[model samples]
Target chain A: MNPYHILNKLLCEEEELTSEERKAFVEGLKSDPELVRVFTGWLQVHSHLMERLPETKDLILYSLAADGHADDLTHQEASYISDHWKDIDSVVESHPGFKDLTHQIAQDRQDFLDCWGSETASVPQVFRLPAWSYQIAAVIAVLAVAAFATIFLVNYQDRSMQLAIATPGEYQRILLPDSSIAHLSGPATLEYNSERFGRSVQLTGQAFFEISHRPKQFIVRTNEAMVQVLGTRFGMRSGNDMTQVILESGRVQVASNETPPRSIVLAPGQMTDVVKGEAPTPSIDVNIEDELRWTGFVFLRNTPMRKAAVLLSSSRNVNIDVDPLLMRESVTGTFSPDIPIQEVLDALTLTLNAQVIEDEDGFRIVPLFP
Target chain B: MAASKFDPQLVLRAKKGDERSRNVLLERLSVVLERFFKRKIGDQALVDDLIQCTLLRVHSGLIALKHPDKFKAFAMKAALFELHDYYRGRHSMKERSFEPELLPEKNYSINQSSGDSMDVEKALELLKPRTRRILELREHGYKYREIADILNISETAVKMQVKRAFEKMKTIFAD
Candidate 1:
């Protein structure tokens, strides 16, 4: 008797089995310990599944269009939905019936609000006017508000005062007041003020910038160095003691804030590092894309073990203690920020001929024993 | 359920102040939380907020976690606490129709918690979509007959899919 067959019949089938078939099922489970173990495991899995909820995106959409009170949504949810609105839009757009339904619903914001909003008292007053008349009135009201806001901004507000910050373990992409885009890995901050008309940004930590081309000098100031560009794409990292800049495209000038301050101009595919009170390193050719992996994952190519450790620690924001002797060993491979940290350690151990001890204090990388 | 090879090292690194490891751990567990919350809250928009709250607690409380191998259990406890806190904050307003019978067993043992499901989840990713769906339905307590009806397939097909999914899962968990 096939135990798997009998077990499946017992577990999955709804109909009652014959006396002989039931006998076979019980006999299979009673005789084979492996079958019993598998069956027990399946029961545990079933119990666990019973505790979980199904993924129901379609049902959620149905509820959203029918119920407008999204008080349940936090700020993150709103931003996520707004950012991925195209995905939701695409779904409705692909279907002609949904397209028509959305078009009808969109034209009447009040109708959507009435359906989805938690409040019901306003529905009667909102319905007092005809739909077309209400829409025209709403349009005028919106334009009037927009015109007032525009005048207020032109007359009183500072256009460039804004701050973009990326928190630890996160990435942020912000559009500068000047229309340039800044991508920052966490523990980074970018500050712009109207004093520079948004042309100058003070940066700490690490960031990638795509400056818009303009006659105005777009300057990025770091603790150790300053980057000046008309319009370009670049990546910059400022540590406690040194500042590094890599220009991906266009031209930029890097000025070190040393005692004997020196300025160097850089073209595409060039990188320079500046140390406080010391001259900046000569620009070297590096793949800027490869260096930009702090924002994502990067593969190392013939990188020394010491350098790899430093990169891993920096990227993960973790403390890694490596022996001085193993620092000279070289490793050539890729590292992804997605997998578990042990897997990376295992790979390092295999490649670099090293051993890692993970304890309560931290991870220690040492020379492998014979 | 036993801990898989993936999370313990990441948890160890995370506990040691590795922000990247922490982020990866959160990302993977957030998927699990999303599924958990979606079933409980029945509201998609609310799910993200609960997940964020759970993560905040997890992050703040991770330092106190004594065992790296028990990270999943610790995190899930924080998640359940957040759920309790949310309902308490709402003054016990019933957001949706929920029966106690449908709830997770109150006597659920942390030792027997669904740590193994993470491995099963990974294995399910490798299965055919139909087979995975069949197993998922089964996990949700759907009988083979019901799954067959829902999928418009034969009962034999449902049984075959369940067996195949279990076989694949067994192989994955073995490693």
Candidate 2:
């Protein structure tokens, strides 16, 4: 007999498997690493399915029982219920939430019935209007709603805001009305009212913000803390009842969202964290490039090509060799880390009329002609 | 019984671009999928997402289904795919630096507690649909002979599928 058959019989606890076969299967699992791995995998999948997949018959019967319609069960259903009453009862006893599940099922069934209107109902011919009239009425109603919604949305848009969400595996770059830039990491949401514009935004997860200088302070708020900046670049991450703000090139004031909030000002290359219901921690020095790596935005402001290349190579885990003469040349640009390193290098070299060459070890940036 | 209740004629009509039939089919499927998901996962929001994703999968894949009679299996397969994707996402979330505070409390708890193993679900995707069906049925407490009867194949064929599924899983685990 196949080992899987024996395994299946053992899992099912069937008496059909010979004792010798069962012993052999157990012994193989104990002795062979490969067999043990496969068996473990099989068992995991089996348990997961058992836990996730409902026993249709039991579920149907349970729903009926929970709904107080046990009397309506068919003869076969009643027989199965009687035979498996202990198992069914144990399951129901364990999952107290099954009642809510039945209620949800009833609601779902009602929704289905509502969507699938009475197909069996017959309308009197005298009361039936021409199909074209119904269509025309629907079109008119739709137009009226559309017109109203358009006006409402126009007003609502001014008052409420726009929401930008970056799901897992996505990096989104958004430009605020004031020409400020917000680079959102995956699994993050940034919401800001258009009317409020670049002044303030609510953030969840993590984001790097480049704020434009303005009279009104630019603020980023999270559940735990708030960050206020003026014409500065910084990365803010909020989670686990704590918010951390790291200032890169400018100053930022971090404060707890709690009442009587204690605040701390973070200078360039410094970071602070605000725990829930507490004051912001004192600013501590940090490596700005390392801290903001998640945003994948490399901000270079008149930095020499040598330093830029080192930063790029470290951030992207690639070796970049710049030509000797070009090392002293300065590069000024904000590069999105998501773009391929090669593409970014190409674009960067393009500005200097230089070329990028690829080799097995990594990439080398040399003068276009030399 | 759920499979028996699914009308292949409606699926055929939906495949032929019958809007009314498609709407009705999807509505019924939504109820089934909701129940299927709710039983497994307690998060209503995740259940709702799974239902919508599965429905979309079924809708898009409906055109490619050659045998309308296999609609239940097809729909179930779609649901399985969505569920698998959900588990896979949860697994990857563990490997990555996901902000747990961003997830709703209940969903966070569920995600943290489940899919902690080496994830055999990915390996299951390598099996043929028929073989997968047999393995799933067997896992659900159906005997090999019963699964063979349900799929209208011989008992030996069902055993073969089980063996093949395990062999495939073994290779995946080995790697």
Candidate 3:
């Protein structure tokens, strides 16, 4: 047999050669540099291609596995599987890459099917849209009616359209239709028109808004004020006849809800307050990370030990004390709220080179030597 | 974040210019691409860059895709293209010198560590466009018979093209 023929058979894994042919092929490779070069080049391409492209048969197997061997298989796919069942079984058993690919593809298929539901196959009929079309048309009609009903209900409910709420002691993350995120600290409610979601929202209590950018303004209304932004992130708290707005990044306009609606523009790291009947207070530069710490992210920007203790105490509801000598020492780092308070304390004390003494009441920071 | 599944409906919606759906699809594709690249290349930073590039390619080419159900195949091809680009770029940057003395060493085993210097992309460029396509289809896990069916050629012809392409690569690289 020609050496090139043997090389092709070996690379394609078409068939096992007889022992004599294998010996001749090995001897040719050992003696012939030109043949070896051809073999090497072909082998490299084959291996890389195998790594990059999934086999067609494996894709079919994957589809079968993904769809759970249901009646959903196409006639072609069903036939292909039947014809190659033996080869497919052997490959799945022996080829780890194909096995992994099949598993991954099946998992991905299941995830999407769960997310979007299986595609509704249309039943063929003479001179008409498939049966799914009628089903879809009926669904659309019903949805139209339901939409009108929802609009009526919204009007009747006086715009109390509560879309999301976090009760006391609960922290909830709401993904708005516009892809904006609202991290609501408990005792908060976010409401907006279902039909006109992402344009604006009514926020009661404290929440952090990461508004997706758009040309139109996104408005957040509170009892005492309204915050308007094109695209930006900010934190808002409305309660006690007062509303506070703090901009983390981007820009926002805070206005009082009073007649004439006094407004002020706030830059990043600035905050403002609105009294029930007064215009929004002048924007003041503030530590946004510290102010928005309620959103479960601790931002310490050169925060003094004394101030850090106060902030941690209020946020964690634990009394923290710092020795006078260490009070002025500051620490800077961002900590996720998920970190245990003890771990945070250890980190803080480690930075200060101090020791934390835990007592029945709370934690006290003192010099390690002392 | 959980890996997002491939949804043909989402692809259709995105192709129809649904901004929200497009965003969702891109986000989901990112998750899937991240996993795919990470599995292929373990470097986190490189994987991230590959994911971004693949997502961009998918986004730009989505409207041109004729079949929504083939989104996985389309996205995977885009990913493979990007990956190949990376490999080619890395090889060129390294400027690996192929020593003539190493020609005989190639006979040792395809699994030899030095096999990385083969520069498969360069060798692939040596083939004719038709032959290259056949080889590509073969690489994509298509059988020789399937390639013949796809290209409307004979199976023996497909095998002949592949063999000739390998011979051409050997001639070019042996110099």
Question: Considering every candidate listed, which one attains the maximal lDDT?
Answer: 3
Q: Model 3's lDDT to the true fold?
A: 0.68
What docking tier does model 2 reach?
Answer: incorrect
Clashing pairs in 3: none
Predictions' DockQ, in order = 0.05, 0.08, 0.07
Task: Give the alpha carbon lDDT tens digit for every residue of A1-370 in model 1.
Answer: 6656555455445445666766676666556656555544555454444334222333233323434624323344445555656665664443332343333223323332332232112211123667789789999989998998998677545543667788875677665645566778788998886323447888988887877665667899988998999888788988788889988779999998876789899888799999876777899998753676775544466677777877787777677888888877777544434434665765667545577899876688987773
- Which candidate tops TM-score? 3
Q: In angstroms, how far off is A361's CA in candidate 2?
A: 7.3
In model 1, what lDDT does residue B150 have?
54
Better of 2 and 3 by TM-score: 3
Which 10-residue window in model 1 chain A sums to the lowest lDDT? A117-126
Candidate 2: list runs displaced more than 4 Å.
A1-160, A195-198, A299-334, A338-343, A346-354, A358-362, A367-370, B1-175
Residue range B1-175, candidate 1, lDDT tens digits: 3334335777889888998988877876676676566444434567789999988998887887767775644654456556545643542212111223212334322224456666544555677777756655544334554455556554445665665666655555445
Least accurate 10 contiguous residues by lDDT in model 2 chain B: B93-102
Candidate 2 on B1-175: residue-level lDDT in tens? 1232356777899999999989988887887776666544424678789999989999998998777876754665466557545643442211012123222323222222355333655665677877777655554444444454456554445554565566567677678
lDDT score of residue A63 within candidate 2: 56
